[model samples]
Target: MLDQTDHDDNEPSAPIDMLEAYYAAHNWEFERHDDEIVASIKGSWTTYELRALWRDDDSVLQFLAFPDIKATDDRRPALYEAIGLVNEQLWIGHFELWSSSGILLYRHAALVDGEEEPMLSLSGAELLVESAIEECERFYPVFQFVLWGGKSPREALAAALVETHGEA
Candidate 1:
């Protein structure tokens, strides 16, 4: 097992570039990379897990797992819930990857909050749902698709906006 606490001095591969190479056939672009996590290519969506021990090298790692068409429904709602907290002091999240059989396998832990009690906490289903919703928003009208239970990117993001701003 790899030591989670070990921080390799090597630079972690840029998630954007890695994702781009993996989905070269689709409309791809780098979105964000903070800390050890990165996201890119809003369209032609596929998730990737590091294939080998990156050891903090110059931004190129292999990851085999991708999005599963089956987990879209059961997981989207939880994802939506997580996105709602993005602006809150308690919100922290990552991309939830799953197998084609609908079983969740991995997640890319990206966001985090440093509050005393940490306001945001999400169920497994919620994480999957949020990741899918995130893709829809980034990919938009060009790559129209929904992965969550009944919430599409349009609905989930809109609701998040409303819930966040509306409550204020």
Candidate 2:
């Protein structure tokens, strides 16, 4: 129940309230990062991720987010969810979903120096893994269903990826 019903584009009060409610239910703390809202959760052994939000030029909503991850040696892009504000318009973003673990790998879009073109770069694997481990500790059931044999589905798939790329 996100409140995107306000007629005034300048006033983003409703959406803010919806986000607050959503996070509160999940036991996350929400904070303001410039013009965006960041939601964070705390854990014992691992650190939680910071989910972020903002508005596009058309008043469409955008989420700069991450999936729960485990610490790995690979340097790869993470998955992110870019849900559309309304039904018609598509909110564009890229992410790699781990079918086994049901974890998402997100790459946040960043402003490159002296470049007009927007860039989506891979976040640090350490951070991503820490976030994922925290999430797994908090929500074990979902992760259990998503992953197989205590590993994300992507791990199983990675073997094939090497063969596909002729690395084998």
Candidate 3:
């Protein structure tokens, strides 16, 4: 059994180790190198690149999910508006467009601090990752519609947010 209280000098490896355990438990194939866990999870609309980095200095685990695509310059304005509207409805995390890459992604950070010992747990990791996946699955089409469908932000969002009852 791995010791949960083994936070030595705020080493970054501890969080990654915990995440390794979490991935194993969920049967997820992931690559661990340095302070990051890299995995690709397939969603309803696309495949997401899950990049989780352990920030040793800040004691934060930043989890990012990229949707395997990037925004073009012409679509930037509409994409930005859609992101704002989507972000307003998100309760846990928000979406961001990396300036240099123009890649869209979901961002969430979890503070790894334990009162008695390290608070890092598999359940916590699962919660954060699952939440990102859920949000990504729900809103992915809004990006696609605006970026590729030649639709306005409002139109794209409305089409994506429409509720369908029961299985078709």
lDDT by residue (tens digit), candidate 2, 1-168? 222332223232333344444455455677865546666665553445555443433333344444355422231222111111111121333344555554554433322221332222122222332344443343333223334334343442332223343554
List candidate 1 segments past 4 Å from native.
1-94, 104-106, 109-149, 163-168
Model 3 TM-score is 0.87
- Prediction-by-prediction clash tally: 11, 13, 0
Model 3: pairs clashing at backbone N, Cα or C within 3 Å:
none
TM-score of each: 0.21, 0.34, 0.87
Model 2 — which ten-residue stretch has the worst lDDT? 79-88
Give a tens-digit lDDT track for model 1, residues 1-168: 122222232223234333333223233333333322233432345543322112233322222223333445656455444434332322333333343454332233333222332122222212433454454344332112344435555564455454333543
Error of 3 at 5 (Å): 19
Runs in model 2 deviating more than 4 A are 1-13, 42-47, 68-104, 107-155, 158-168
Task: Give candidate 2's whole-model lDDT.
Answer: 0.38
Error of 1 at 38 (Å): 22
Best by lDDT: 3
The worst-scoring run of ten residues by lDDT in candidate 1 lies at 117-126
- Residue-by-residue lDDT tens digits, candidate 3, 1-168: 223333333333366787776666556688999889998767788878888898877889899988876999888888899999999989998998988889999999988976644456655666788899899998999999999898899998999999999998
Worst 10 residues of 3 by lDDT: 1-10
